[model samples]
Target: MEDVIVPIVLFSVLPVCIWLVSYFNYRKRLTAHETVRHAIDAGQTVSPELIEKMSLLVDPIRADLRRGVLFIAFGAAFAVLGMMVNFEDGDALMPMLGVASFPVFLGLAYLGLWAFGHGNKSA
Candidate 1:
């Protein structure tokens, strides 16, 4: 049970925690962008301060996406390692390898979201 469970916990929890962190970070940046956009929409001058902050906020999301991808990759590698090493005959370690794909899929999904968000193109 430990063999099966430990990997699941690692493959599942690590990415989720990282995703949550990235999500919160993205949300914070989004809120700031909206605030700046609202200010601009209101007929107020686009201050240099707000422009600087917006630029800074936007730059990190790409980096965070990359970091999330890296975390997924690491999880996959760990899963592979887990699969190759046989602890007991009845152990279902390969299933855990499959489980690792969840994070990879999540990272790809986030990348897709990042791409979709590009240029703020709205219909």
Candidate 2:
């Protein structure tokens, strides 16, 4: 029962955590935009630099590259875990490899996107 519960909680919590982070980030951006709107209504000069600083935009290609590396590393860690578990029990490796493949393929896709977008200014 504990084993089943632990896995269930872990998988469930991951999506919740991701959602929370995205929610908070959205709220932050909303607040920032509201502040800018208020300042504009007050007839204050809002400079482009100030907006740029507040926006904190990251390069999409660079972000993709970073995510790709991180996902690949994460997948590699899972693969290593699978190998270690396999040493203890023979049946664990294949299932873990199957699980690891998702992240690895996702990482490869991100890397491919990064590569394709690297040369394009609009990307």
Task: Give the winner by TM-score.
Answer: 2
Clashes of 2: 0
Score each candidate by Cα lDDT.
0.74, 0.87
Model 2 Cα displacement at 114 (Å)? 1.4
TM-score per candidate, chains pooled: 0.46, 0.69
What would the per-residue lDDT of candidate 2 be over residues 1-123, giving only the tens digit for each residue? 999999999899979988996897678778888989999999999999988677654457876898899889888989999999999999999999988888899899999999999999575
Q: Which window of ten consecutive residues has the lowest lDDT sum in model 2?
A: 52-61
Number of the top candidate by lDDT?
Answer: 2
Residue lDDT tens for model 1, 63-121: 55685687688678868766676465347587777767777777777677667655553
Candidate 1: regions farther than 4 A off: 1-50, 53-55, 58-64, 87-93, 121-123
